[model samples]
Target: MGCTFRPHFGYCRRISTKVNVLITVSDDIYDVYGTLDELELFTNAVERWDINAMDGLPNYMKICFLALHNSVNEMAFDILKEQELHIIRYFKKRWADLCRAYLLEAKWYYSGGDVPKSIQCYMNETGASEEDAREFIRCLISATWKKMIGEQSMTSPFSKTFIEIEFNLGRMAQCIYQYGDGHGVRNHETKDHLLSLFVQLIPP
Candidate 1:
């Protein structure tokens, strides 16, 4: 459930419209992009691709939506990695086994028409204080990416989009972390060594 870091090629065309949206109450991000703002970005994903109008999406359109999806997914990877490590460091095998079991359960629940329950189980597994559990939480985002974006829902069969999304996530995350040194002070919005280091790492 992790990205190996690579890029996928496709034509991305923008579609614009308003949407009825839900604001997620929480996040795990390297930076705090405003929730309403990101919500618009995501709602536009569906609108931009004309997803709401379609009864069923063709494979090509699905791929385009997946790309937009992953770009938003990138915003949270760094914070997810940080918390995953903390939990994994504390919980050990119990957390690992629990997450594994929960992964199975989530798959089962998803297949069995208990989607909200499945999401809850997935989140519960992630909330534990174990390395494996936490690692699952972090990498699971990639798993989700592969499933939704690559059309491979089973985590065991990951694809390039999944790997590249996480890879790009990691790169940008390192950029964000190094950009601030956790000071959360000074010119966070300006050019600095941390950002310079990020540029060196990814050449952005």
Candidate 2:
């Protein structure tokens, strides 16, 4: 199947404010493994409005965050693993707020952690009769393509082909509803006018 396509919306209510806050921090902690103290620093500071506390951190912080988030849940650890990789590919330097937001997608449902969204994406992408909430690895792979590869390739010296991030989102939603059952993506509905672009390209 091809990537998903969604129309561009000018902006959401807080997207602009959040984006400005998310990308303004001048740090990429992906490279530097944090000491116990360093971990506590950002963990504590993140709650506040200032991200400058993370400034100049190594590039490995992103990695550490992914690792920590995965360890928080096992049922969806596999999906979490791919999600981590997707974030790593894009930042290539540090973890961003958007990454953090998606990582926390599950928190909104099933109480906390990657409870269903991640698994739903996996299940939807794989189109597997996984019954136990399984997913195709390709969805996460496409995440890297849509968020990392496609975004990065766009500015690189190569042909810039954008992956349809919107399609992946639907597949994700399908997985959420399929796997989540009663506890589906109640926190955030993935449906959107954007899904219209898929037409015959992706399954509804």
Candidate 3:
């Protein structure tokens, strides 16, 4: 991936890779480690951008929050210094939003109802049948993809390399989640997929 995108800008490769890793780690923090109370505290801390907000959090949560906070800020600083672009606010907001979404899922899991595995909102809010909820989600995913693809051709304040990196991030996510939570859980197919892409050699 780095070699393929190097001509566009080698720096983008490093930043994009870091961002992807951060995304996965953040997902685990929300999915695996967080309890309702802890996740709420952490989410609020991120939204507030306050180290003081770390008070009362578990040690593990503090560590996760600090890592996310510092790494994102550092990356934002690098972007500002190098490109004169300040995107820290956007990054912070995105993190907060993601945490809220995860919190919703966690709440649903704790709820005593037999909630559908995905699209809980669609299932719970509108009293939609499972089939209808699935269809709605499919359309929503298609719309999101359309929006992202449309951005590829738009006139943006960001650099072309940055735009390409964003596109690649979306593509990577699609690949990882296409067959389920492939990144979070190991399975034979996921292992084979990774090996085929990263381990097996292909002759020119």
Give the number of the best model, judged by lDDT: 3
lDDT of 3 by residue, 64-157 (tens): 7888889889989998998999999999999888878877777777775443567677888989997899889879878999998887787889
Backbone clashes in model 3? 0
lDDT for position 64 in model 3:
79
lDDT of 2 by residue, 22-59 (tens): 33331223112344345445454343323454454445
Name the top TM-score candidate: 3
Instruction: Score residue 102 of candidate 1 by CA lDDT.
Output: 37
Error in Å for residue 120 of model 2? 14
Regarding lDDT, does 2 or 3 come out ahead? Answer: 3
What's model 1's TM-score?
0.22
Per-prediction TM-score: 0.22, 0.23, 0.72
Greater TM-score among 1 and 3 belongs to: 3
